[model samples]
Target chain A: MPPFLYIFLGALAVVSALGVIIQRNPIHSLLALIATLMTVAILFIGEDAVVVGFLQIIVYAGAIMVLFLFVIWLLNLQVETGPTGHLALKLFGSLAAALLVTELFFILAPPHLQVKFTHEPVGYGSLASLAGTLFTDYLVAFEVTSVLLLAAVVGSVALARRLPGTDDPRAARKIAS
Target chain B: MIPLTYMMSLSAIIFAIGVAGVIIRRNILVMFMSIELMLNAVNLAFIAIGSRLGSMDGQVIVFFVMTVAAAEAAVGLGIIISIFRNRETVHADDLTLMRW
Candidate 1:
Protein backbone atom coordinates (compact mmCIF):
# COMPACT_ATOMS: atom_id res chain seq x y z
CA MET A 1 0.00 0.00 0.00
CA PRO A 2 1.23 3.45 -0.84
CA PRO A 3 1.66 6.03 1.91
CA PHE A 4 -0.70 8.62 0.46
CA LEU A 5 -3.49 6.13 -0.08
CA TYR A 6 -3.13 4.89 3.45
CA ILE A 7 -3.42 8.45 4.72
CA PHE A 8 -6.46 9.10 2.59
CA LEU A 9 -8.22 5.97 3.80
CA GLY A 10 -7.23 6.69 7.35
CA ALA A 11 -8.66 10.17 7.10
CA LEU A 12 -11.83 8.91 5.48
CA ALA A 13 -12.27 6.32 8.22
CA VAL A 14 -11.72 8.80 10.99
CA VAL A 15 -14.09 11.33 9.51
CA SER A 16 -16.80 8.74 8.98
CA ALA A 17 -16.31 7.47 12.51
CA LEU A 18 -16.84 10.95 13.82
CA GLY A 19 -19.93 11.14 11.72
CA VAL A 20 -21.17 7.99 13.41
CA ILE A 21 -21.01 9.60 16.85
CA ILE A 22 -22.10 13.05 15.79
CA GLN A 23 -25.33 12.08 14.11
CA ARG A 24 -28.55 12.78 16.01
CA ASN A 25 -30.40 9.96 14.29
CA PRO A 26 -29.53 6.32 14.70
CA ILE A 27 -29.98 5.61 11.00
CA HIS A 28 -27.50 8.30 10.08
CA SER A 29 -25.08 7.00 12.65
CA LEU A 30 -25.51 3.53 11.23
CA LEU A 31 -24.74 4.77 7.75
CA ALA A 32 -21.63 6.58 8.94
CA LEU A 33 -20.46 3.47 10.74
CA ILE A 34 -20.95 1.47 7.56
CA ALA A 35 -18.79 3.94 5.72
CA THR A 36 -16.16 3.68 8.40
CA LEU A 37 -16.22 -0.09 8.28
CA MET A 38 -15.97 -0.04 4.49
CA THR A 39 -12.94 2.20 4.62
CA VAL A 40 -11.35 -0.10 7.15
CA ALA A 41 -12.12 -3.02 4.87
CA ILE A 42 -10.33 -1.25 2.06
CA LEU A 43 -7.41 -0.71 4.36
CA PHE A 44 -7.40 -4.35 5.30
CA ILE A 45 -7.36 -5.39 1.66
CA GLY A 46 -4.62 -2.90 0.88
CA GLU A 47 -2.60 -4.47 3.67
CA ASP A 48 -3.02 -7.83 1.90
CA ALA A 49 -5.46 -9.38 4.38
CA VAL A 50 -7.88 -9.96 1.55
CA VAL A 51 -9.98 -12.66 3.15
CA VAL A 52 -10.30 -10.82 6.41
CA GLY A 53 -11.22 -7.66 4.54
CA PHE A 54 -14.04 -9.34 2.66
CA LEU A 55 -15.22 -10.97 5.84
CA GLN A 56 -15.31 -7.56 7.40
CA ILE A 57 -17.51 -6.39 4.58
CA ILE A 58 -19.80 -9.39 4.37
CA VAL A 59 -20.17 -10.18 8.03
CA TYR A 60 -19.85 -6.88 9.84
CA ALA A 61 -21.13 -4.36 7.34
CA GLY A 62 -23.49 -6.71 5.59
CA ALA A 63 -25.21 -9.04 8.04
CA ILE A 64 -24.85 -7.26 11.37
CA MET A 65 -25.62 -3.77 10.11
CA VAL A 66 -28.65 -5.00 8.25
CA LEU A 67 -29.89 -6.44 11.50
CA PHE A 68 -29.44 -3.09 13.15
CA LEU A 69 -31.39 -1.33 10.44
CA PHE A 70 -34.17 -3.83 10.79
CA VAL A 71 -34.43 -3.31 14.51
CA ILE A 72 -34.33 0.46 14.23
CA TRP A 73 -37.18 0.41 11.79
CA LEU A 74 -39.05 -2.23 13.74
CA LEU A 75 -38.85 -0.14 16.90
CA ASN A 76 -39.65 3.05 14.95
CA LEU A 77 -36.89 4.93 16.71
CA GLN A 78 -36.58 7.96 14.48
CA VAL A 79 -34.43 10.47 16.36
CA GLU A 80 -33.16 11.03 19.83
CA THR A 81 -35.52 13.32 21.71
CA GLY A 82 -34.06 13.89 25.16
CA PRO A 83 -30.95 15.61 26.34
CA THR A 84 -27.91 13.70 25.09
CA GLY A 85 -26.62 12.88 28.54
CA HIS A 86 -25.06 14.49 31.55
CA LEU A 87 -22.85 17.15 30.10
CA ALA A 88 -20.20 16.45 32.70
CA LEU A 89 -19.94 12.85 31.57
CA LYS A 90 -19.55 13.95 28.00
CA LEU A 91 -16.76 16.36 28.87
CA PHE A 92 -14.91 13.88 31.01
CA GLY A 93 -15.41 11.17 28.42
CA SER A 94 -13.84 13.26 25.70
CA LEU A 95 -10.95 14.06 28.01
CA ALA A 96 -10.49 10.40 28.81
CA ALA A 97 -10.54 9.46 25.16
CA ALA A 98 -7.85 11.99 24.41
CA LEU A 99 -5.72 10.58 27.19
CA LEU A 100 -6.28 7.05 26.03
CA VAL A 101 -5.26 7.86 22.48
CA THR A 102 -2.07 9.56 23.68
CA GLU A 103 -1.31 6.57 25.86
CA LEU A 104 -1.86 4.13 23.00
CA PHE A 105 0.36 6.18 20.73
CA PHE A 106 3.09 6.22 23.34
CA ILE A 107 2.90 2.48 23.73
CA LEU A 108 2.98 1.91 19.96
CA ALA A 109 5.72 4.47 19.33
CA PRO A 110 8.81 2.41 19.83
CA PRO A 111 12.02 3.34 18.04
CA HIS A 112 11.51 0.40 15.68
CA LEU A 113 8.01 1.59 14.78
CA GLN A 114 9.04 2.31 11.22
CA VAL A 115 9.48 -1.38 10.44
CA LYS A 116 7.78 -2.01 7.11
CA PHE A 117 6.02 -5.18 6.08
CA THR A 118 8.64 -7.37 4.44
CA HIS A 119 7.47 -9.38 1.46
CA GLU A 120 6.17 -12.79 2.46
CA PRO A 121 6.14 -16.12 0.67
CA VAL A 122 3.12 -16.71 -1.49
CA GLY A 123 -0.24 -17.33 0.22
CA TYR A 124 0.35 -15.43 3.43
CA GLY A 125 -3.13 -13.95 3.85
CA SER A 126 -5.09 -16.35 1.69
CA LEU A 127 -8.13 -18.32 2.86
CA ALA A 128 -6.45 -21.70 2.37
CA SER A 129 -3.44 -20.56 4.34
CA LEU A 130 -5.70 -19.25 7.08
CA ALA A 131 -7.53 -22.58 7.13
CA GLY A 132 -4.17 -24.30 7.27
CA THR A 133 -3.40 -22.54 10.53
CA LEU A 134 -6.97 -22.58 11.87
CA PHE A 135 -7.65 -26.26 11.21
CA THR A 136 -4.27 -27.45 12.37
CA ASP A 137 -3.48 -25.24 15.37
CA TYR A 138 -6.71 -23.50 16.33
CA LEU A 139 -9.01 -26.33 15.35
CA VAL A 140 -10.67 -26.72 18.72
CA ALA A 141 -11.25 -23.01 18.93
CA PHE A 142 -12.92 -23.00 15.55
CA GLU A 143 -15.33 -25.71 16.56
CA VAL A 144 -16.07 -24.03 19.86
CA THR A 145 -16.92 -20.86 18.00
CA SER A 146 -19.73 -22.69 16.24
CA VAL A 147 -21.07 -23.74 19.61
CA LEU A 148 -20.78 -20.23 20.87
CA LEU A 149 -22.75 -18.93 17.91
CA LEU A 150 -25.52 -21.48 18.55
CA ALA A 151 -25.70 -20.51 22.19
CA ALA A 152 -25.98 -16.86 21.27
CA VAL A 153 -28.82 -17.57 18.91
CA VAL A 154 -30.72 -19.56 21.52
CA GLY A 155 -30.11 -17.02 24.24
CA SER A 156 -31.15 -14.06 22.15
CA VAL A 157 -34.34 -15.77 21.05
CA ALA A 158 -35.20 -16.55 24.63
CA LEU A 159 -34.65 -12.99 25.75
CA ALA A 160 -36.52 -11.40 22.90
CA ARG A 161 -39.45 -13.82 22.99
CA ARG A 162 -42.64 -12.30 24.39
CA LEU A 163 -44.77 -15.02 25.97
CA PRO A 164 -48.27 -14.09 24.99
CA GLY A 165 -49.86 -15.98 27.86
CA THR A 166 -48.36 -13.65 30.47
CA ASP A 167 -46.87 -10.70 28.63
CA ASP A 168 -50.00 -9.76 26.68
CA PRO A 169 -51.87 -6.96 28.46
CA ARG A 170 -55.16 -7.66 26.70
CA ALA A 171 -54.91 -11.31 27.68
CA ALA A 172 -54.50 -10.34 31.30
CA ARG A 173 -57.48 -7.96 31.15
CA LYS A 174 -59.59 -10.69 29.59
CA ILE A 175 -58.67 -13.03 32.41
CA ALA A 176 -59.66 -10.33 34.95
CA SER A 177 -63.02 -9.74 33.20
CA MET B 1 4.60 -0.34 2.01
CA ILE B 2 3.01 1.95 4.56
CA PRO B 3 4.71 2.32 7.89
CA LEU B 4 3.29 -0.03 10.52
CA THR B 5 2.89 2.84 12.95
CA TYR B 6 0.67 4.74 10.55
CA MET B 7 -1.78 1.88 10.42
CA MET B 8 -1.52 1.33 14.13
CA SER B 9 -2.03 5.01 14.79
CA LEU B 10 -5.17 5.06 12.71
CA SER B 11 -6.37 2.11 14.69
CA ALA B 12 -5.73 3.91 17.94
CA ILE B 13 -7.49 7.04 16.77
CA ILE B 14 -10.57 5.15 15.66
CA PHE B 15 -10.65 3.19 18.86
CA ALA B 16 -10.50 6.37 20.84
CA ILE B 17 -13.33 7.80 18.81
CA GLY B 18 -15.32 4.70 19.62
CA VAL B 19 -14.66 5.10 23.29
CA ALA B 20 -15.80 8.65 23.11
CA GLY B 21 -18.92 7.60 21.27
CA VAL B 22 -19.86 5.08 23.90
CA ILE B 23 -19.42 7.53 26.70
CA ILE B 24 -20.84 10.66 25.16
CA ARG B 25 -23.90 9.15 23.54
CA ARG B 26 -27.01 8.32 25.54
CA ASN B 27 -28.80 6.27 22.91
CA ILE B 28 -28.25 2.60 23.55
CA LEU B 29 -28.24 1.64 19.88
CA VAL B 30 -25.65 4.23 18.99
CA MET B 31 -23.59 3.12 21.93
CA PHE B 32 -23.79 -0.38 20.58
CA MET B 33 -22.58 0.84 17.21
CA SER B 34 -19.69 2.59 18.93
CA ILE B 35 -18.77 -0.66 20.60
CA GLU B 36 -18.72 -2.30 17.21
CA LEU B 37 -16.45 0.45 16.01
CA MET B 38 -14.10 -0.21 18.88
CA LEU B 39 -14.01 -3.90 18.06
CA ASN B 40 -13.21 -3.21 14.41
CA ALA B 41 -10.46 -0.83 15.41
CA VAL B 42 -8.87 -3.64 17.40
CA ASN B 43 -9.26 -5.98 14.44
CA LEU B 44 -7.44 -3.51 12.25
CA ALA B 45 -4.59 -3.30 14.72
CA PHE B 46 -4.39 -7.06 14.90
CA ILE B 47 -4.19 -7.38 11.14
CA ALA B 48 -1.66 -4.60 10.92
CA ILE B 49 0.61 -6.13 13.53
CA GLY B 50 0.12 -9.60 12.16
CA SER B 51 1.18 -8.50 8.71
CA ARG B 52 4.11 -6.63 10.18
CA LEU B 53 5.28 -9.86 11.82
CA GLY B 54 4.64 -11.91 8.65
CA SER B 55 2.26 -14.23 10.51
CA MET B 56 -1.30 -15.40 9.88
CA ASP B 57 -2.28 -15.45 13.55
CA GLY B 58 -3.58 -11.91 13.39
CA GLN B 59 -5.92 -12.67 10.55
CA VAL B 60 -7.22 -15.79 12.26
CA ILE B 61 -7.74 -13.94 15.50
CA VAL B 62 -9.63 -11.25 13.64
CA PHE B 63 -11.88 -13.97 12.26
CA PHE B 64 -12.61 -15.12 15.78
CA VAL B 65 -13.22 -11.57 16.90
CA MET B 66 -15.74 -11.09 14.14
CA THR B 67 -17.60 -14.22 15.18
CA VAL B 68 -17.70 -13.21 18.80
CA ALA B 69 -18.79 -9.74 17.82
CA ALA B 70 -21.62 -11.18 15.79
CA ALA B 71 -22.89 -13.17 18.75
CA GLU B 72 -22.47 -10.22 21.03
CA ALA B 73 -24.42 -8.02 18.69
CA ALA B 74 -27.25 -10.51 18.49
CA VAL B 75 -27.60 -10.93 22.21
CA GLY B 76 -27.10 -7.24 22.82
CA LEU B 77 -29.73 -6.09 20.36
CA GLY B 78 -32.09 -8.66 21.70
CA ILE B 79 -31.64 -7.23 25.14
CA ILE B 80 -32.14 -3.75 23.76
CA ILE B 81 -35.39 -4.73 22.08
CA SER B 82 -36.65 -6.42 25.18
CA ILE B 83 -35.84 -3.41 27.28
CA PHE B 84 -37.45 -1.06 24.83
CA ARG B 85 -40.53 -3.24 24.68
CA ASN B 86 -41.00 -2.86 28.39
CA ARG B 87 -39.69 0.63 29.02
CA GLU B 88 -40.43 2.25 25.61
CA THR B 89 -37.07 3.97 25.61
CA VAL B 90 -33.53 3.07 24.59
CA HIS B 91 -31.71 5.80 26.39
CA ALA B 92 -29.19 4.52 28.90
CA ASP B 93 -29.88 7.36 31.27
CA ASP B 94 -33.61 6.70 31.17
CA LEU B 95 -33.37 2.97 31.85
CA THR B 96 -32.47 3.30 35.49
CA LEU B 97 -34.92 0.91 37.04
CA MET B 98 -32.10 -1.20 38.41
CA ARG B 99 -30.12 1.74 39.63
CA TRP B 100 -29.98 2.37 43.32
Candidate 2:
Protein backbone atom coordinates (compact mmCIF):
# COMPACT_ATOMS: atom_id res chain seq x y z
CA MET A 1 0.00 0.00 0.00
CA PRO A 2 2.96 2.26 -0.16
CA PRO A 3 2.57 5.33 -2.35
CA PHE A 4 5.55 4.26 -4.41
CA LEU A 5 3.90 0.93 -5.25
CA TYR A 6 0.73 2.71 -6.25
CA ILE A 7 2.60 5.04 -8.56
CA PHE A 8 4.71 2.27 -9.97
CA LEU A 9 1.70 0.09 -10.76
CA GLY A 10 -0.06 3.06 -12.32
CA ALA A 11 2.97 3.70 -14.51
CA LEU A 12 3.05 0.07 -15.54
CA ALA A 13 -0.62 0.21 -16.44
CA VAL A 14 0.05 3.26 -18.59
CA VAL A 15 2.94 1.58 -20.36
CA SER A 16 0.95 -1.55 -21.18
CA ALA A 17 -1.79 0.71 -22.45
CA LEU A 18 0.70 2.25 -24.83
CA GLY A 19 1.64 -1.23 -25.99
CA VAL A 20 -2.00 -2.02 -26.67
CA ILE A 21 -2.25 1.05 -28.85
CA ILE A 22 1.05 0.70 -30.63
CA GLN A 23 0.86 -3.02 -31.33
CA ARG A 24 -0.39 -3.69 -34.83
CA ASN A 25 -1.34 -7.34 -34.34
CA PRO A 26 -4.61 -8.17 -32.63
CA ILE A 27 -3.12 -10.92 -30.50
CA HIS A 28 -0.40 -8.58 -29.26
CA SER A 29 -3.05 -5.99 -28.45
CA LEU A 30 -4.93 -8.53 -26.38
CA LEU A 31 -1.76 -9.44 -24.56
CA ALA A 32 -1.19 -5.79 -23.78
CA LEU A 33 -4.76 -5.55 -22.53
CA ILE A 34 -4.17 -8.49 -20.24
CA ALA A 35 -1.07 -6.81 -18.86
CA THR A 36 -2.96 -3.58 -18.32
CA LEU A 37 -5.75 -5.44 -16.57
CA MET A 38 -3.32 -7.16 -14.22
CA THR A 39 -1.63 -3.89 -13.30
CA VAL A 40 -4.93 -2.16 -12.65
CA ALA A 41 -6.12 -5.05 -10.53
CA ILE A 42 -2.92 -4.76 -8.53
CA LEU A 43 -3.56 -1.07 -8.18
CA PHE A 44 -6.98 -1.81 -6.74
CA ILE A 45 -5.51 -4.32 -4.30
CA GLY A 46 -2.92 -1.79 -3.27
CA GLU A 47 -5.70 0.70 -2.63
CA ASP A 48 -7.24 -1.78 -0.13
CA ALA A 49 -10.28 -2.65 -2.21
CA VAL A 50 -9.67 -6.36 -1.83
CA VAL A 51 -12.92 -7.69 -3.29
CA VAL A 52 -12.92 -5.37 -6.26
CA GLY A 53 -9.30 -6.03 -6.92
CA PHE A 54 -9.81 -9.78 -6.94
CA LEU A 55 -12.86 -9.46 -9.10
CA GLN A 56 -10.97 -7.24 -11.52
CA ILE A 57 -8.25 -9.80 -11.88
CA ILE A 58 -10.56 -12.80 -12.06
CA VAL A 59 -13.25 -11.41 -14.29
CA TYR A 60 -11.10 -9.29 -16.60
CA ALA A 61 -7.67 -10.87 -16.81
CA GLY A 62 -9.02 -14.39 -16.41
CA ALA A 63 -12.42 -15.07 -17.94
CA ILE A 64 -12.93 -12.17 -20.33
CA MET A 65 -9.45 -12.22 -21.77
CA VAL A 66 -9.68 -15.95 -22.25
CA LEU A 67 -12.86 -15.41 -24.21
CA PHE A 68 -11.10 -12.90 -26.45
CA LEU A 69 -8.24 -15.27 -27.07
CA PHE A 70 -10.60 -18.12 -27.83
CA VAL A 71 -12.41 -16.08 -30.45
CA ILE A 72 -9.18 -14.89 -31.96
CA TRP A 73 -8.04 -18.46 -32.27
CA LEU A 74 -11.34 -19.53 -33.79
CA LEU A 75 -11.27 -16.74 -36.38
CA ASN A 76 -7.67 -17.32 -37.44
CA LEU A 77 -7.22 -13.69 -38.53
CA GLN A 78 -4.41 -13.24 -41.02
CA VAL A 79 -2.38 -10.07 -41.20
CA GLU A 80 -4.74 -8.44 -43.61
CA THR A 81 -4.37 -4.75 -44.50
CA GLY A 82 -6.71 -2.18 -43.05
CA PRO A 83 -7.86 1.20 -44.29
CA THR A 84 -5.70 4.28 -44.18
CA GLY A 85 -8.42 6.73 -43.46
CA HIS A 86 -7.77 10.40 -43.97
CA LEU A 87 -6.05 12.30 -41.18
CA ALA A 88 -9.03 14.58 -40.75
CA LEU A 89 -10.99 12.13 -38.57
CA LYS A 90 -8.13 11.65 -36.17
CA LEU A 91 -7.55 15.41 -36.05
CA PHE A 92 -11.19 16.09 -35.33
CA GLY A 93 -11.35 13.44 -32.63
CA SER A 94 -8.25 14.78 -30.90
CA LEU A 95 -9.56 18.34 -31.01
CA ALA A 96 -12.91 17.29 -29.64
CA ALA A 97 -11.35 15.27 -26.82
CA ALA A 98 -9.07 18.16 -25.87
CA LEU A 99 -12.00 20.55 -25.82
CA LEU A 100 -13.93 18.17 -23.60
CA VAL A 101 -11.05 17.92 -21.14
CA THR A 102 -10.70 21.70 -21.09
CA GLU A 103 -14.40 22.12 -20.43
CA LEU A 104 -14.27 19.59 -17.63
CA PHE A 105 -11.39 21.46 -16.02
CA PHE A 106 -13.29 24.72 -16.17
CA ILE A 107 -16.38 23.12 -14.72
CA LEU A 108 -14.48 21.61 -11.81
CA ALA A 109 -12.46 24.78 -11.13
CA PRO A 110 -15.11 26.72 -9.22
CA PRO A 111 -13.93 27.71 -5.74
CA HIS A 112 -17.26 26.96 -4.07
CA LEU A 113 -17.69 23.58 -5.67
CA GLN A 114 -17.07 21.17 -2.85
CA VAL A 115 -17.48 17.61 -4.08
CA LYS A 116 -17.66 14.70 -1.68
CA PHE A 117 -16.27 11.41 -2.86
CA THR A 118 -18.43 9.35 -0.54
CA HIS A 119 -21.77 10.73 0.65
CA GLU A 120 -23.44 7.43 1.53
CA PRO A 121 -24.71 6.78 5.05
CA VAL A 122 -23.34 3.25 5.21
CA GLY A 123 -19.63 2.71 4.74
CA TYR A 124 -18.70 2.14 1.12
CA GLY A 125 -16.42 -0.54 -0.47
CA SER A 126 -17.72 -3.27 1.81
CA LEU A 127 -19.63 -6.13 0.24
CA ALA A 128 -22.49 -5.55 2.67
CA SER A 129 -22.97 -1.93 1.71
CA LEU A 130 -22.51 -2.59 -1.98
CA ALA A 131 -24.97 -5.48 -1.97
CA GLY A 132 -27.51 -3.54 0.08
CA THR A 133 -27.69 -0.63 -2.34
CA LEU A 134 -27.23 -2.81 -5.41
CA PHE A 135 -30.15 -4.99 -4.35
CA THR A 136 -32.38 -2.24 -3.03
CA ASP A 137 -32.11 1.21 -4.54
CA TYR A 138 -30.13 0.10 -7.55
CA LEU A 139 -31.81 -3.26 -7.95
CA VAL A 140 -33.69 -2.30 -11.06
CA ALA A 141 -30.57 -1.03 -12.76
CA PHE A 142 -28.73 -4.21 -11.87
CA GLU A 143 -31.48 -6.43 -13.26
CA VAL A 144 -31.64 -4.31 -16.39
CA THR A 145 -27.95 -4.80 -16.89
CA SER A 146 -28.43 -8.55 -16.73
CA VAL A 147 -31.12 -8.38 -19.37
CA LEU A 148 -28.81 -6.31 -21.52
CA LEU A 149 -26.10 -8.89 -21.12
CA LEU A 150 -28.46 -11.66 -22.09
CA ALA A 151 -29.47 -9.73 -25.17
CA ALA A 152 -25.84 -9.25 -26.11
CA VAL A 153 -25.20 -12.94 -25.75
CA VAL A 154 -28.10 -13.75 -28.00
CA GLY A 155 -27.03 -11.17 -30.55
CA SER A 156 -23.51 -12.50 -30.63
CA VAL A 157 -24.66 -16.07 -31.24
CA ALA A 158 -26.89 -14.81 -34.01
CA LEU A 159 -24.03 -12.94 -35.57
CA ALA A 160 -21.60 -15.82 -35.45
CA ARG A 161 -23.80 -18.35 -37.25
CA ARG A 162 -22.89 -18.32 -40.90
CA LEU A 163 -25.23 -17.57 -43.80
CA PRO A 164 -26.82 -20.73 -45.18
CA GLY A 165 -24.60 -21.21 -48.23
CA THR A 166 -21.36 -19.70 -47.03
CA ASP A 167 -19.68 -22.97 -46.14
CA ASP A 168 -16.19 -22.14 -44.85
CA PRO A 169 -13.74 -22.56 -47.71
CA ARG A 170 -11.46 -24.85 -45.74
CA ALA A 171 -14.39 -26.95 -44.64
CA ALA A 172 -15.68 -27.18 -48.19
CA ARG A 173 -12.30 -28.31 -49.44
CA LYS A 174 -12.11 -30.92 -46.72
CA ILE A 175 -15.54 -32.21 -47.66
CA ALA A 176 -14.53 -32.34 -51.35
CA SER A 177 -11.53 -34.53 -50.50
CA MET B 1 5.60 12.64 -0.68
CA ILE B 2 3.58 13.22 -3.82
CA PRO B 3 0.25 14.94 -3.30
CA LEU B 4 -2.99 13.22 -4.37
CA THR B 5 -3.50 15.86 -7.02
CA TYR B 6 -0.37 14.64 -8.77
CA MET B 7 -1.87 11.19 -8.98
CA MET B 8 -5.02 12.62 -10.45
CA SER B 9 -2.97 14.57 -12.95
CA LEU B 10 -1.13 11.46 -13.99
CA SER B 11 -4.43 9.62 -14.34
CA ALA B 12 -5.76 12.39 -16.54
CA ILE B 13 -2.71 12.26 -18.76
CA ILE B 14 -2.99 8.50 -19.09
CA PHE B 15 -6.66 8.83 -19.98
CA ALA B 16 -5.86 11.42 -22.62
CA ILE B 17 -3.32 9.12 -24.16
CA GLY B 18 -5.89 6.32 -24.23
CA VAL B 19 -8.39 8.58 -25.94
CA ALA B 20 -5.84 9.55 -28.51
CA GLY B 21 -5.00 5.94 -29.16
CA VAL B 22 -8.61 4.97 -29.61
CA ILE B 23 -9.08 7.81 -32.04
CA ILE B 24 -6.05 6.94 -34.12
CA ARG B 25 -6.06 3.13 -34.10
CA ARG B 26 -7.81 1.39 -36.94
CA ASN B 27 -7.50 -2.11 -35.54
CA ILE B 28 -10.48 -3.10 -33.43
CA LEU B 29 -8.33 -4.99 -30.96
CA VAL B 30 -6.05 -1.99 -30.45
CA MET B 31 -9.08 0.21 -30.00
CA PHE B 32 -10.28 -2.17 -27.30
CA MET B 33 -6.91 -1.90 -25.56
CA SER B 34 -7.16 1.87 -25.63
CA ILE B 35 -10.54 1.58 -23.95
CA GLU B 36 -8.97 -0.59 -21.24
CA LEU B 37 -6.36 2.10 -20.76
CA MET B 38 -9.04 4.70 -20.25
CA LEU B 39 -10.79 2.46 -17.74
CA ASN B 40 -7.54 1.96 -15.83
CA ALA B 41 -7.00 5.70 -15.78
CA VAL B 42 -10.42 6.06 -14.21
CA ASN B 43 -9.53 3.37 -11.71
CA LEU B 44 -6.49 5.41 -10.66
CA ALA B 45 -8.66 8.46 -10.20
CA PHE B 46 -11.04 6.42 -8.09
CA ILE B 47 -8.31 5.14 -5.78
CA ALA B 48 -6.81 8.60 -5.39
CA ILE B 49 -10.15 10.23 -4.62
CA GLY B 50 -11.14 7.46 -2.25
CA SER B 51 -7.94 7.85 -0.24
CA ARG B 52 -8.09 11.64 -0.31
CA LEU B 53 -11.62 11.71 1.01
CA GLY B 54 -11.07 8.81 3.39
CA SER B 55 -14.18 7.25 1.93
CA MET B 56 -14.93 4.19 -0.16
CA ASP B 57 -17.51 5.18 -2.79
CA GLY B 58 -14.77 5.56 -5.34
CA GLN B 59 -13.75 2.01 -4.65
CA VAL B 60 -17.32 0.81 -4.96
CA ILE B 61 -17.66 2.54 -8.30
CA VAL B 62 -14.48 0.93 -9.41
CA PHE B 63 -15.98 -2.44 -8.58
CA PHE B 64 -19.06 -1.76 -10.66
CA VAL B 65 -17.00 -0.41 -13.55
CA MET B 66 -14.84 -3.49 -13.48
CA THR B 67 -17.85 -5.77 -13.70
CA VAL B 68 -19.29 -3.78 -16.54
CA ALA B 69 -15.94 -3.87 -18.26
CA ALA B 70 -15.86 -7.65 -18.04
CA ALA B 71 -19.30 -7.93 -19.53
CA GLU B 72 -18.29 -5.57 -22.27
CA ALA B 73 -15.22 -7.60 -23.02
CA ALA B 74 -17.24 -10.79 -23.33
CA VAL B 75 -19.76 -9.30 -25.71
CA GLY B 76 -17.17 -7.33 -27.62
CA LEU B 77 -14.97 -10.33 -28.22
CA GLY B 78 -17.98 -12.29 -29.28
CA ILE B 79 -18.90 -9.62 -31.76
CA ILE B 80 -15.36 -9.50 -33.02
CA ILE B 81 -15.43 -13.22 -33.60
CA SER B 82 -18.67 -12.90 -35.51
CA ILE B 83 -17.27 -10.11 -37.62
CA PHE B 84 -14.17 -12.06 -38.36
CA ARG B 85 -16.28 -15.01 -39.36
CA ASN B 86 -18.08 -12.98 -41.99
CA ARG B 87 -15.23 -10.84 -43.27
CA GLU B 88 -12.17 -12.73 -42.02
CA THR B 89 -10.67 -9.42 -40.97
CA VAL B 90 -10.57 -7.47 -37.72
CA HIS B 91 -9.88 -4.07 -39.18
CA ALA B 92 -12.16 -1.19 -38.19
CA ASP B 93 -12.54 -0.12 -41.79
CA ASP B 94 -13.93 -3.55 -42.74
CA LEU B 95 -17.03 -2.81 -40.69
CA THR B 96 -18.68 -1.27 -43.69
CA LEU B 97 -21.70 -3.52 -43.61
CA MET B 98 -23.42 -0.99 -41.37
CA ARG B 99 -22.30 2.22 -43.08
CA TRP B 100 -24.67 1.62 -45.92
Best by lDDT: 1
Q: Candidate 2, clashing residue pairs? A: none
Query: Would you list the C-alpha lDDT of every candidate in the order shown?
Result: 0.90, 0.70
Per-residue C-alpha lDDT of model 1 across residues A26-52, encoded as one tens digit per residue: 999999999999999999999889999
**Global Cα lDDT for candidate 2:** 0.70
Instruction: Compute DockQ for each candidate against the true complex.
Output: 0.70, 0.42
Q: Give lDDT tens digits, candidate 2, residues A68-161.
A: 7787678775453554334886786577657756654554444532545443344445677657656776677678778867876777667666
On TM-score, the leading prediction is: 1
Highest DockQ scorer? 1
lDDT of 1 by residue, B1-100 (tens): 6777788989999999999999999999999999999998999999898888888888999999999999998999999988877777888888777866
Name the DockQ score for candidate 2.
0.42
Q: Give the range of the ten consecutive residues with the poorest summed lDDT in model 1 chain B.
A: B91-100
